[model samples]
Target: MTCKSSTTPVMGIHLHDIHSMASKLETLTKNQQLDQNDIKSILIVIDLNPEPMSIDDELESSKLTRKEFAKSIKKLAELKLIDWDFNW
Candidate 1:
């Protein structure tokens, strides 16, 4: 995303920009209508710097409750939409 706005950071990106991108990703990840929050959560887990993301980390990184996150992850896995290994 090339921003011509004066508020744009000279280098790197603003944290708010990342959140905005995630919001956009909610509707842009697929052609079909899927659970937006679930998709966003999965993207967060996958986009993070390191592999083997922990359950606790996912909970902490997201606004979702443990149960909610687990449910989404499980659903995505069952649909074969995602298959990354994370710490339990």
Candidate 2:
């Protein structure tokens, strides 16, 4: 994803850039009730799996409980950050 700043437009964001941005955002929002682990898990899943992953597979890989994973996924979806389809 390319981000446009006031000065210039960033073109072609890579995975590393996304991770860095997320980390910086997390640090900037210290008082926010955001779960760093959940963000990390989502990034890891995106990095590790090029294809769409099942909910169970993502939960197992991220080591998050069903509830936690579901919550995170819902939040991510609400933010329009991830495009996921529930086949099951």
Candidate 3:
């Protein structure tokens, strides 16, 4: 992901520079409604499964049931945070 500064057209924010600070931003942006555990769970699945991970796979990896993982992914999709495509 590329982060462009609003004030500077020529500058881009490097991921390494803001990587540490994004966690707090993520929490606040998620409306502070989701706890750290929830965010951690989601991140774990995303980080581990770079490919198009099936809902079942994510659930199994995160120790969450299929239903729970589905709900979380649905919310993430609604937030425009992830793009999912189904071929089958």
Candidate 4:
């Protein structure tokens, strides 16, 4: 029941940040695709869970049911799903 890692954040991102944004980003999307230039897009970044988590973890944290969360979203407009398989 513990977060896998706190000190060693994955890709310079922390789980706590995700936990904090959980409520804000819930009912939205996971594994959001973004970069420095696109950071200003609150609609996507904030709406979509900007945190990266494993398929299992994302489903668990999502407000949507486990079966409801869709993995590997092909595209969001011009954006594509960016997922990292680090076993997070």
Clashes of 4: 0
Q: Name the better of 1 and 4 by lDDT.
A: 1
Ordered from best to worst lDDT, the candidate numbers read 2, 1, 3, 4
Deviation in angstroms for 35 in model 3?
16
How close is every model to the real structure, measured as TM-score?
0.34, 0.34, 0.34, 0.23
Could you tell me the lDDT of residue 14 within candidate 4? 30
Root-mean-square deviation of every model: 11.5, 9.3, 10.8, 10.7
lDDT of each: 0.42, 0.44, 0.40, 0.33
**Candidate 4 local lDDT, 1-88, one digit each (tens):** 1222212323332333343333333334454634534322222221234346554565555554432322212122213313322222
Which structure is stronger by lDDT: 1 or 2? 2
Clashing pairs in 3: none
Judge candidate 3 at residue 86 and give its lDDT.
29
Index of the highest-lDDT prediction? 2
- Give the runs in model 3 whose Cα sits over 4 Å from its true position: 1-58, 86-88
In lDDT terms, how accurate is model 4? 0.33
